[model samples]
Target chain A: MMVSQRPSEVSTSAHERVYRTLRSRIMYGEIAPGQALTLRGIGREFEVSMTPARESVRRLVAEGALFLSSSGRVSTPELSNERIEELAALRALIEVELASRALPRAHMALIDRLQGINMTVAEMISKRDAVGYIRANLEFHRALYLRAQAPAMLAMAETVWLQMGPTMRALYGRLRRTEPPRNHKLIIAALKAGDEPGLRLAVRSDVTQGLRMLAG
Target chain B: MMVSQRPSEVSTSAHERVYRTLRSRIMYGEIAPGQALTLRGIGREFEVSMTPARESVRRLVAEGALFLSSSGRVSTPELSNERIEELAALRALIEVELASRALPRAHMALIDRLQGINMTVAEMISKRDAVGYIRANLEFHRALYLRAQAPAMLAMAETVWLQMGPTMRALYGRLRRTEPPRNHKLIIAALKAGDEPGLRLAVRSDVTQGLRMLAG
Candidate 1:
């Protein structure tokens, strides 16, 4: 007998399945910066043909989540300090606006949801799981931003996040922090208080602070 | 004997050539919003096989320059009013920052080049050439932003431009202006006076003023 599958899983196309899974892995810092990927290897790993594999890579490359070299090699980007700073600034610009838009709509349930995600972020930190930490942290921010009803802005912010993922992994190794980011608490408090400027500042600081150290 | 070709043209891959040409067409509003494109049609037009055409389409879709429906139709996006506003806000945020960053680096030569581009923009507007006007307008903004030395930020800004391309064509038709945007002159004045805040305001106004009306 066939095993039951989730409705979403059942509806996903093979190429889309491969694309979503690979995109998450890269975006969560499961892949290291400058790591190379081969179409043959990806096809074998995902149990798909080269066409789907190539399409996924092309999509990721277009999103700036992957880099394609002149020699026809595909790899995660190894961003320079300047590039890192620019991406971080973009995150600050976009995410701060997202947070500000989300402020008036930030109900008790959303704040609670953010708090719950923050706990997961702390748990990942304590467990020393860098990828999990990054994923949870993003979830926390995304949960807040979702209330903004600004899909285009959120997408832009996520693209910046995807571009920074590998570098964030590298930074996680260098950081070795025992606590979660303090800015998350500030963000939550600002949201609860309905403080737009505070929320914007907190969001900007939360997004840019860590990356600034790396850029420096 | 084979006709002479440009070195850049000779070096471009089949897919890259197709991708670049198609990207420009879409970005310049040569295509209407909600216009459908078939792979077979694209392949015939470009004299290429299905693979390169598919690749180019996939890349554009990922960049938000095109949309892919669940039924497997590919078309230029017909953006909603809300989406248009969000994208305009994004342009204001990023382009203003880019202009501010580029200010100190804007030499007299660059200002002259910008004026020359503004002339072309006016010429296109007077001729009622929507595509040419869009292309020249982008060139003027891009020439200024290139001095920012922030590729990642610029790429994000360009993606927003790509998404707005078709909508911009519609706006151009509605506008039917006899004069260029007044904000362009303000931008030039601010740059000449080395006024940072003035430069930011001008850039933000220039990018968002036209689109705000469409969204409204």
Candidate 2:
């Protein structure tokens, strides 16, 4: 007998596939702030039906990664300066705690992994790949925070990052930096020394400094 | 002339109505942890169609207010001890900051209103109304945090609260507390005195103390 796939199973996978791909696009800043999208367009891009596309959009909207207007228009959010500051503060608060928790558990291998990710981050900077840079930078942080054994906190931190992704892409264009963030080096050093306070400071600065400038 | 509503508009409102009502039910602990829900049941309860019910469930799942199983079952989450502790720490982190920020803006009117809410909290405790207790307790915190002018931070705080809601209801049954939380009085006093440090400590204590006892 041939294996039977139910319609719900098919739709579930399609919806999840579309949701994850679109989530990364917004989370990595591949989509710019205020960029509009339609369900039809998303369906066409993902080669999925409208139901899956609509579900994906609804999920992203719930996470604050995408905005759905009263008129049923969907777009990336253009955050106000105050909103940016609030999110930056949230990032600072949550990420700093994550780094602090990770400090005790951060082994040599994890630090080395972070440093390797940092190298990729620098290369992305040199190549002027905003999306690549953002992705690698988050990889570095996530690498450290994974050791914290605090999935809920890490999830909260990622939500903040997702919300800031589009605006961060906008900031990347403005900064035009030749090097990766200096705070990454500080973070690596603090991790090596197992300095909790230093790690907290480095993480707070790394997460908020660029965003504060953008907010200003 | 008859006014015609678009299909999308009709579905949107129906979905929103279902979502908000269910969200409050979860947030106020009217629903217990590990409580299973079905789309057909939700649709019948809300008197809406399957589409809106599914959409509402999806949104709540995204918000961490509900959990969706791999096989497509939906329920309120049954958080582990570690998850509970992490969420408690997050509540301490974000709510303390919110309270500190609101202190400068915590005028007499706001303090009076908070005291009023506190009274209701006591009444709920005496009545042994778990959901009412959680609702009025959150009303106290939310009223204070609203003056912080930090919607993102407040939203983050509320997400933590939502995650803890069912657990808090369980804790309520276990503790059999006959009075309002003592830390709340400290918070009110700190607000009246404009003591930032005191306010932060009070908020931290208020948010974490009960949860820690439960986790222990």
lDDT of 2 by residue, B1-216 (tens): 433445655654888999989989999998999999999999899777788899999998988999999899999999998899999999999999898889898899999999999999999999998889999999999999999999989888888888888888888877655866799999999998888999999899988887767855
The stretch of ten residues in a row with the least summed lDDT in candidate 1 chain B is B1-10
**C-alpha lDDT (0 to 100) for residue B22 of candidate 2:** 93
A213 Cα displacement, candidate 2 (Å): 3.0
Number of residue pairs clashing in candidate 1, backbone atoms closer than 3 angstroms, sequence gap of 3 or more or interchain: 0
Taking the tens digit of each residue's C-alpha lDDT, what string does model 1 give over B6-45?
4456677778989999898899898999999999999899
Using Cα atoms, each model's DockQ against the true complex is 0.88, 0.89
* DockQ, computed on Cα atoms, for candidate 2: 0.89
- RMSD (CA, Å), candidate 1 to true, equals 3.8
Q: Spell out the clash pairs found in candidate 2.
A: none
Top-TM-score candidate index: 1
Q: Give the clashing pairs for model 1.
A: none
RMSD of 2: 3.3
Model 1 lDDT tens row, A56-119:
9999999999999998899999998889889888999999999999999999999889899999
